[model samples]
Target: MPSKIPDVVAPGTLARGEQPVIPVPGDLVIRPWVLADAGAVYKAFQDPLLQRWHARVADSESEARGWIEEWRASWADEHNAYWAIAAAGSDEVVGRIALKSVVLADGQAEVAYWTMPEARRRGVASRALTALAGWAFDEVGLHRLELTHSTANEASCRVALRNGFATEGTKRSAGPHEDGWHDMHLHARIKGDGPTALV
Candidate 1:
């Protein structure tokens, strides 16, 4: 075990400090979730499309609050990082984004996101992803960031591409949705990949 490279990102890199609010283009800020956002979280899960792909719905505001608590705990544990995508100076959540399954030693993590119905088609996903990717690469020293979405989700594919995450390949039945297991399109971006912008 000693004959290996050191951790690309130090262990305390994230857990040692509070998750900072990240400002993205389009007047949106990615910030930590609060209990007050429970209603919005519940409503988001009720969206048919969200439920279709994510395969779970918040049964009550209390459950949504629990989800928020879990998100906060994830940051403390340094296993995952989640943020609420909201308008600047507003608490209303327009979307959500996260660096999932973070592996500090490997300098890699999976990205996941979703936008509210009102926030769709407004570049929220792309802009938020760009900001998150920047933070992961520049601030956290992560080397590789992966994005995977159902092959059938054209919108998500476009978001990935717009953020400079190149199409790596497809994973057969890699994601479970309300409909069933679905093939997934895997996209990835590595550090020094060059500027990330809307394509």
Candidate 2:
């Protein structure tokens, strides 16, 4: 027997137009990244942990600026949706998140994020993740949001689970990092997994 294809709004068609500021509880804000945020992003990239997990080092403001440009290009192409996490009522960016490798035809997207070194342990990632997941499911009409992190990265795993993403399994040696290959843990949140705030 063959599995029937899911009835979805279809991938690549969800992000149709203008992006807006998304407010989450706890005075957290998520908005599209801009060139003005380059400085903060560069500062974050200086964190050893960030560079370790992301496997990219930014030695100068110019190099970090390229990362921002790449993100902007991705947004324009609709290949990814990136955001800067900031304090509510402020333009200062403190962290980042994205609905990447989006497949609107399948009504699915992947969630990824990293908090500024100074912002860690403050629930920045969790709040941003929750707010974004809800928006993706309810407004963007996505059915599933996938999240993958290194098995050794328990903090990220906790963030995923805290946001209603259930662990499905692990992929052996799926991700390469500064140290070596890491087994990737996969988690996902489907529509209705939990409450999501549209705002």
Off by over 4 Å in 2: 1-7, 10-15, 195-199
Please give the lDDT score at residue 72 for candidate 1. Answer: 83
Give one digit per residue, the lDDT tens place, for model 1 in 1-199.
4837788988888999999999898788999999899999999999989887897779999999999999989998888999999999666799999999999888999999999999999898988998999999998899999999999999999899888899999999889887789999999999988535663
Q: Which ranges of candidate 1 are over 4 A from the true structure? A: none
**Model 2 Cα lDDT, one tens digit per residue, 99-176:** 998877678889999999878998889889988988888887888999999999999988888888999999999999
Please report, as a residue range, the 10-residue window in candidate 1 with the lowest summed lDDT: 190-199
Which has the greatest TM-score? 1
- Lowest lDDT sum, 10 consecutive residues, model 2, at 7-16
TM-score of each: 0.96, 0.90
Q: Which candidate's lDDT is highest? A: 1
Clashes of each: 0, 7
Q: Candidate 2: lDDT of 48?
A: 81
